[model samples]
Target: MSVVGCGYLGVTHAAGMAELGHRVIGVDVDAAKIATLAGGRSPFFEPGLDELIARHLANGRLRFTTSYEEAATADVHFICVGTPQLGDGTAADMRYLDAVVETLAPYLVKECLVVGKSTVPAGTAARITSMLRVLAPAGESISVAWNPEFLCEGKAVSDTLHPDRLVLGVPDEQAEKVLREVYAPIIDAGVPVVVADLPTAEVIKTAANSFTATKISFINAIAEFCEASGADVTVVSDALGYDARIGRQFLNSGLGFGGGCLPKDIRAFQARAHELGVGQSLAFLAEVDAVNLRCRERVVEYLRKQCGGAFTGRRIAVLGAAFKGGTDDVRDSPALYVANLISQQEGEVAVYDPQAIENARRAFPNLVYERGVLEAANGADAVAVLTDWPEFGTVDPDVLGEVVRSRNIVDARHALDPARWLRAGWNYIAPGRPALQPALVGTV
Candidate 1:
């Protein structure tokens, strides 16, 4: 078996497959990335992937290369390339997926199953089938399948080695058999397999992400109304979360959803719906995007207000830069976006994250990067917890207060403990909750 396109998804999948006892060849177009994997290290930052790559490489089950010819011997191929949002920011760019299938097609000299792990439109399998049938030397021997992955970034290794379920979109019985054989270890260990036609498997991935995004936006949109009525959304969200019908997963009432998947998947789903002439079906997604964007704006405005209605000279500390905790990917990250917005307002901003500082620096070179949380918080007029890193939640407010010039804190991610900050004589503010301001200097 082989895993092609060794980015986040591909590398993790390749490692997981090798761990499952398959002789896996990992392929990528980038020579530098191939070299990194070949040397038993990961090119990116995922918690447990480097260890897996090293263990598998030493055991002789995993290897990487930049050429497609080297992977031609494997009859089972997993296409794990990314489908990023296009330049227009509305539709998915299928160029990488196209290139993978085209490049691998001519090398199909024997019978093979070209399994797609990348998220794509509903009818993409049929188009690829046509392409493979025309391009491959073995013609109909090349079977097309869609096996969309649902691994979260931070917990990718665990998610892959033990997924909730394995989805297989097969054209015929033979394709299903090949997939079941490929994932036999997982299947034997009791992971449910959802076998369906090509289109259903494709749509399931997008549908799941859209629903999760909606829940996040629903709570955030409610947070907006809570601000108007002086109602605390945190309490309201907790109350609603108790109902089994509306559980408390993505109901955090903070900076909504970002990272590689939710943002682009929602937009791409909308674009696909429009192309199918049912644009109105997913119109609410546009609002979801709006509410998520507004959360960033709310943070910027809160910081500006903390600066006495002027952001020109405020020394603001922004914590966390990855879209969320657990991964260093800053693509469409809310924390990084807000930091950039503050910098644009001419505010002195210092940003810090445990794993995302370097990534954030590459994305926005002008913003101040801090080695530690205290460095960012030191001598600041106000501190805003933008990304909900567990460390941000656990950092002692009393210690944080000692370094800052003022005791103003706004928990944009609602990550910090307001009670702890208030007790330390700091004015604590958070979205959807009343301000827990500390006592005045003379009042005590």
Candidate 2:
């Protein structure tokens, strides 16, 4: 089996396929990524990926290359390229997926099944299948299948090893049999597998992501109301969670959803719905987008309010930059959005993160980057915990309180304890919860 485009998904797929005893060749157009993987190093920070890559390297089952010909000859080719959101931020840019299909078309020898593992708008598999049939030497016989990836970044390896369900989109019976054989190891391992038509499989991925994003935005919207009405969103979500109908997965309300998958997938789904003349049906996703975008603004506002005035001349320290913790992907990161807002207001903002600083620096070169949490908080008026990293809870509030000019803390992720900051004689604030009021002047 071959995995094309060795980004996060490609690397993970390659490692897993090789672990399943298939000789895997990972193909990528990027020389740097190829070189990195060839040396048995993972290009990104995924738990267990480097070790898995090294293990596969030792077994000689996994190889990395920049050649499409090496990839095209594989019995089953998994196209795992990225389809980022279009410039307008609505449609999906299928350029990468399209290029991979075109590159692998000429070398198709027999009845090969090219499985798509990237998240794309519904009906994309059908379009690509048509294109491949026109391009490949075995045009009439070459098959395409859609098997979209459902794994989140942080838990990708585990998710792949033990997926909740597998959706295979195949056009014909022969294609289904080939894919079933390809995933036979996983099927034997007892993971739920579903085989459906190409269009339905494509829809499954977009729909699943959109639903997850909608659930997140739903709680965020409720959290806004919870803040206004003196109610706890955590409690509300907890109670709502007890009902089996509204299972608690994406219902945690904090900083809004932002990553490679959730945000872009929803927008692409909405864009596709519009293109298919169902624009009115998906209008609520526009609200979901608005709700998600609004949460970032609310964080900026909460920080400004805690600072006791304008953001023009305050030294604010921001913690965390990856969209969520555990990965270095900074695509559409909410923490960076919060930091950018503070910096744009002419405030002195210092940013720090465990793993995402380099990507954050490339995204926001104008903002000041800090080497550690202490340096980010040094001499600042307020400190905002933007991303919920595990190490963040270990940072001593008392020490940070000593360096900051104002002992005002905004825990945007609701990460740190509100009472602990107050015990340290600092004012603490969090969204969807009441802020601990500042002590009256000259009062013990």
Worst 10 residues of 1 by lDDT: 435-444
| lDDT of each residue in 1-444, candidate 2, tens digit only | 889989989999899888888899999999998999989899888888899999998899999999988777788899999999998768999999999988889988777788999998888888888998899998977778888888888888887777889898888888888877877888998999888998899998888888889999999998787776666777788899999999977778888989888888888888899999998888899999999999998888878876776888899999999998889999999999999988988889999999999999999998899999999999898899999789898888888887888888878787887778889987776666642432311111
How does model 2 fare in lDDT? 0.86
TM-score of 2: 0.96
lDDT of 1 by residue, 178-239 (tens): 88988898999999999999999999999999999999989988877777666778889889
TM-score for all models, in order of appearance: 0.96, 0.96
The 0-to-1 C-alpha lDDT of every candidate, in the order given, reads: 0.89, 0.86
The alpha-carbon lDDT assigned to residue 365 of candidate 2 equals: 96
How many clashing pairs in candidate 1? 0
Task: State the TM-score for model 1.
Answer: 0.96
Considering every candidate listed, which one attains the maximal lDDT? 1
